[model samples]
Target: MEARLKKTECVKQAPLAQILPPVILGGAGFSYQVYPDPNISQVRQVLRQAFNLGLRAIDTSPYYEPSEELIGQAISEPDFANRYPRDQYIIMTKVGRLGADRFDYSPSWVRCSVNRSLERLHVDYLDVVFCHDIEYVTEEAALDAIGILLEFVREGKVRYIGASSYRIDLLLQLAQSVLDRYGRPLDVVQNWAQMTLQNNRLETDGLKNFRDLGISCVCNASPLTLGLLRSNGVPVGSLGDFHPAPAALRTAALRAADYVAEQGESLAALALRYAIWRARATSTSDFQVSTITGIGSTKELDENISAISQILLPTHGSPINSARVERDAPLWNKVQEILGSWLNFNFTSPEANWDVQQQKFVKLKL
Candidate 1:
């Protein structure tokens, strides 16, 4: 009896989010390019694993290779939807990227995209439909397209409306336009966040400003950073195909690997779990799971889920000083110092060409 009490007390000394709240799963697999050639069989197998692993959220885009079609197949399979009720899951998809890797804001395309997404996912409506990469889109243009999605929301075909990682200027523009023109606020925002502790545009730009305005942020790029974490210490070469970067970014990635090694844990696991730890206060961190990619298989999923669950157990510690200075500030400064020489280049924004200066390593390959 005393041993049981001691064991229970031991379990009570860790962060709760790490162990408890089912980590919102990032579903990008069926269409993820990591696979050689993803077909229906591969897609079904991936979905089977995802559902079995207790993932409640699956995010996809029509742009992902055959992802929509594969999802439809999986959902239509025997007793799948019956077992996992539609409402029990949160499925987020995006519109706006129209013709072959290009972005479009036409209201007609908006409706068409929603309809297509529904058909692909084997559902009548979406839980959330994002404006999908609206950085270069104008407010008026975005609002015109959003008007259509909102109509679907009103008609009960769409549950919520959100945007994924828009330009700060555009984010503010859209939020204000929605309230002033339509009388409501956007529901969520998705951004690129990883354990690297670097928020190039997120920090220096106006991301915090958007956060203050009551928008929930969904973080992407959490696991890619983990790949970097693994390369230096573990000799895990499976990430080769997934790595699309120049030599400089590759070099920085190696350093990121070393840094992660210094922290005593699987870089991949730590990278994925760290986002949940950091973003717990703000919104949710999206896990980018790719069935087609195969970078994360069932085994990896179990390991990740276990890591998250273990981390989130429970804790009783000294009062958390909300006023505590920034985290790993020195480490970030070191990254800046190391990458300072790598970012010296002139480039135009897809929006506009500006005389810009960068101190961190420029990711030309992304």
Candidate 2:
């Protein structure tokens, strides 16, 4: 067993809202889906560098095969363990949706999953446990899973509980359901691909919904839309093969990427900047906002941090780079104009058809 470390003073005292940084290190890239045959030393270096740079919160899931285990191994290294105790950083993982067609949200599976995650992560307790892709399961099952997580909170196995989904409306509904059923609002809610340059639904449709529910922390993930907005195009292989974006959306993204390239800027960097700006600008006293981005290497980590610094910080004592902002403002508007009808357009998930069938069957039985 790994030796237990003392909880950091700040983590022990602060609430979840204060504990999470504005930029979180996403672990999806650690798996074979995004990166094949990831080196342990590289993972260690990336995690250590991310910690040193203050991107301490790590988000992963079991579905991202080997991600939890790789992270566990990386953080368990003697040098890493000594320099950064477990409490110094936060670990957030998910449960349910084991495979594309598989889901198990029963209380028994919830209990088993939490214990397995603890064992795989080599941690005494998880900082946050989300019901992964709650929209794929029935509402009752989602609620049952949340109740199980809340039990863990009371038992000291988890620090906070939330639900994640690509569907904004479903997330809002689940939050309200949890509140009405359990007498408490969800502590956190995460949605991906909705707060990007092509889509701002998370800002337009999600913020007020979460605020109304009194959620404490809201996270936006996949600022690059699963690599859809990149110059090369949407990724294709393990996870990328399942990207649900329609051809029209993909075409629009390519046009935007071409426009960005013409202006001598990479679409990925522009998207990251806009995502960070939106998260920071929309954050309010009602809830804190954070963005999660995948980092496969130290270089990517540095570039992401650079983007954050450019967007949120001022150089020396001067204000933000207004000149750069002015230059990018027109570029951003032009990209949106290029997107045109695809702006704020959200593509259906790969499982949308299956989910619709399941819902209809449920209604037929009722």
Candidate 3:
């Protein structure tokens, strides 16, 4: 399978620094939560399967016990590493949390985290490193964290730096802070995004604002939300820590699933296509995924790639793919409620060029 993929044009090229890579394919929380206590070989197969499917980016954090090590073990295999250029695939890892000591944003911890991550992943440098779970860290601590990330940039141990799980205002503030102090804006921003509207803050403001600033974003929790949109709702265990699925959210998800199924499409396909398609349609550089459990084998990879390609192709006045349109309803309203005023910003434009007017000046047209 790897040999056959090596001979194919699996990777589609776009601006590297400008456009975030699509299909990131995450690894954490899979074996433990998604698949129970799986063996090392099973974990290795999952990682290799994701790679074989042309997923170039993989997001992991120290919080997910041994995920980084598992990935390292899988990729270290000669057959896998030889199949893809290490640089061709983006390796994004996070810092700030050590054991149960809480998420630390200080320079000391940042440096320590990077070194430890390198040791675990068996890599010399990282494609991108983000400050994870900044919501719990203080403002000063956040700045200090970014400062340490900058140190890594100077040392060339990290190619770019970003912030994860930060609100729209904080993301914008951090970008400005980076520019003012370092003379450059953030290279990437990691946020929660999905098809069925689990998090509207990203769509209404966060996502648009990031694009306006020329910052690429990697979508976390992209698929599990599909389960949220499913009748059973995405289990809280599946969504990680922040903003677990509530009963209200599950109810909404079931409605979305029922509606999508009525339109003759599967709910899972809708979620995957929606997460990527909307990100590209919005011109926010690129979209990313953490896990491609739905897309592991060569056959599944081919099908998913086709689904993505079909979603992007023109279909006349249709706003989305038939499958997408059928699978789910827009959750923008519910999202706004959850995110509140945080969604108030001027990022949505006429779609000519991805220009976002700053908040202070751009009046809310909505």
Best by TM-score: 2
Sorted on lDDT, best first, the list reads: 2, 3, 1
TM-score of each: 0.70, 0.90, 0.72
- Candidate 3, which segments miss by more than 4 Å at Cα? 1-19, 29-35, 98-101, 194-196, 212-227, 236-243, 262-264, 284-366
lDDT per model vs. reference: 0.53, 0.81, 0.56
Candidate 1: residue pairs that collide = 14-314, 18-308, 18-312, 19-309, 19-312, 26-287, 29-290, 29-291, 29-292
| Root mean square deviation (Cα) for candidate 3 | 9.7
Could you give me the TM-score of model 1 versus the true structure?
0.70
Worst 10 residues of 3 by lDDT: 1-10
**Model 1 lDDT at residue 318:** 21
What's the CA error at residue 136 for candidate 1, in Å?
A: 3.5
For every candidate structure, what is the RMSD over all alpha carbons to the true structure, in angstroms?
10.1, 4.1, 9.7
lDDT of 2 by residue, 246-346 (tens): 88888988989998898889888888888877887777544678889987889888877887777766333332455556667887888889989989887
Give the candidate order by descending TM-score: 2, 3, 1
